[model samples]
Target: MSFVHFSVLKDECLQFLTENAPSNSYFADLTFGGGGHSFAIMDLDESYKLVGVDQDPDALKNGAKLIAEKQLGERVELLSSNFSKFPKLIKEKDPEIEFQGILMDLGVSSHQFDIPERGFSFKYDAPLDMRMNYEDDTIETAADICNTRDADELEEIFKTYGEERFARRIAEKIVEERPIASTKDLENIIFHCYPRNMRFGKIHPATRCFQALRIAVNEELGVLTEVLPQLVELLKTGGRLVVISFHSLEDRIVKRAFKELGGKDSPFRILTKKPVTPSKNEIAANSRSRSAKLRVIERI
Candidate 1:
């Protein structure tokens, strides 16, 4: 499948990040899934340069091809690394390099969700593997967590990460049905755990469980927590750090970190008092973007 992702809050991000930008400035797109935001920034000014980073090998390959196809090799540099490691990697490459803008569009890419083999969405009946970098065998797969984690651990993951009301019941059911190796297998287990009336509810019973498994498998929250502070420090004075989170957990972290960094003694100021949500038109065009919340903080 082709790499496709709608850059959430594209206009809002560009407006804030490039409002007072100078010539020959640098920017970073930490989660350059489809190069949507990165390419847009480059298109805004010929002197602007972008460092696009992504851990997914597929994204790196696609980004490289797109850069070459667009003949943007001189302006866009693609890196293969998780967003969490971008600060260290950039420092090693050029300690003096500071970005005018940095963006992180968190959560699984649309490509990842559409590809059934990747197992990110419950709609697919593939292996229950949700690692962002599937090539990294060291990372635990969703199947591993479902099959090995105790009911208590599973319950916590469902409750903390997914906020599922039936976390305990679902966790117990997962434990009862061991060796859940496929998405459908796990989905069935979760579906049966829900009340009969809710089986056909607006939301799928497997949605929260799948989300919880993906979060645990990828350590998404922990990575986000560790990267926010580092990203803020990498920004130049007046530079902006823009983060678009798809879930409340990720949004809360971004909100709290921005608030802490924007304290009176701190060197940052919150740009968006409240997060920017998708317009009704955008949400209607792309339902997946309905939950996206964009937050910005500027170094002072």
Candidate 2:
């Protein structure tokens, strides 16, 4: 399987992480989707050691192959787990390993959307399973949510996570048509929920609803909230933390977390007062990167 995610804000991440990094410094790629950023860092300096974690099986499989192919096996350790567990995992792996840089490219990976069976994209008529870690039975799938969650709960999820304006209408429709087995089925319901004149707009009406389902299925925002401080804790005194979030919800969390963690007496400092975005060229090259916003903070 081809994991085809274009790492967003690649150059910006590399520059910030490598700026004050010492020779043989350790780094962590918390969301190692395509291994693009990790590979770039290794290419930048042969001595830099990297530990990459991804809950998705495909990412880990591809990463292992790529790591061996690039002969980065010795320098790069690819762990198969969600980044939310990084703090504990790091301690178990190496009690003294403090990262010089920790990079988190949040939100759904391009590969996840491109793959039809993953049920991330409404473009395909696949099952409604949107679990980031397919093997995790603890978390409910998107279908489970639609099939079991009450109308009010679904409405809140759609409104809060996706910011969908017609969340209430859509949630009611979803409940009325329970057991929405496929992505296309959910997509159609969301489409008709919109006013006829606005139904065929530039963006698909189902986009936000699908996003809401994915977020809920994966508990993305909550997991991000849990991990941001842990990431800060694992950074070395002068280490940098770079995060690229593709949506406002995630960016807001990143912004608030940085502010909370950075202060005069605090051992951290915000590196980007305003979030950095991809250049026009980059956005043109990868349309999916258009919404990406990067923020960096340094451990003081």
Candidate 3:
């Protein structure tokens, strides 16, 4: 399978990262999907070096191939690990490695959703296995979550992560229909949970429910909360951290974290008071880029 991820807000990320970076600076691409941003950053300067990290095995394999094909072998180093553990990984790889810039593009990649077996999209009829790192046995699959979690927990996930208005109703329905075998099964439950009139809205009825399940299974918010501070610490003075989040929950976390860390007496400064979103042209080109919100902070 071809790893085809359109890096959201690509140029904006590069602008922020490279603007204040010194010559020969080192950077990290924490979610190195398709090696898109990593290669773009490397193209900016021959002296610069990048460490590309991704938890997905497919991404790691494709990234290695991309690096080799681009002849970026000497400049880009690809690591197969979750971005949450990036701090420890960097420490072991190079004790003195402090980044001039770090980037995180959160949410599922296009490749993941397009693959039927990944079960990220309702459009596919695959098993409910929405693990970002499917190889990790410890993390529960989406089906496991639906089948095992209580109604209250499911409601909380839908409300907090997905922000679905009818969270309680949806959760109750899911619990009532236990052993959801496939994406279609879950989709049907959510679709019926919506009112007949509201079911034919601009978005699919299953969108929020699926998003909630994926978030819960991955523990995305908790991981992001833990990793944000570490990224700031990994930066050198004047270094920048650029995060692009696709949903409101993620943007809120990034916003709050930046505010907390960018205050007086703190070592960081928020660069964007409001998040930067994708332009009309980018959105037209890749519709998936539409919901992207980018925030940047610099170590002062």
| lDDT per residue (tens digit) for residues 1-300 in model 3 | 688888899899999999988889999999998888988999999999999988988999999988888898999998888788989978997888899999999988999989999999999899999998999999899999889989999999899888899999989999999889899999999999999999989999899889988998888999999999888989999999999999988999999999999999988999999999999999999999999999999998
| Pairs that clash in candidate 1 | none
* Per-residue lDDT over 251-299 for candidate 1, one digit per residue giving the tens place of the 0 to 100 score: 9999998988899988899989999999999999989999999999999
Q: Rate the local accuracy (lDDT) of all candidates.
A: 0.92, 0.92, 0.92
- Give the range of the ten consecutive residues with the poorest summed lDDT in model 2: 1-10
Which segments of model 3 are wrong by more than 4 Å? none
- lDDT value for candidate 1? 0.92
Models 1 onward score TM values of 0.98, 0.98, 0.97
Worst ten-residue run, lDDT, model 3? 1-10
Please write out the lDDT profile of model 2 over residues 1-300, one tens digit for every residue: 777888888999999999888899999998999999999999988899999999999889999999888888799999898888989988997898788999999987888888999999989999999998998888899999999999999999999999999999999999998888999899999999999999889999999989999999999999899989888988998899999998999999999999999967999999999999999999999999999999999988
**Candidate 1, 88: how far from true, in Å?**
1.0
CA RMSD of each candidate after superposition? 0.9, 0.9, 1.1
TM-score winner, 1 or 3: 1
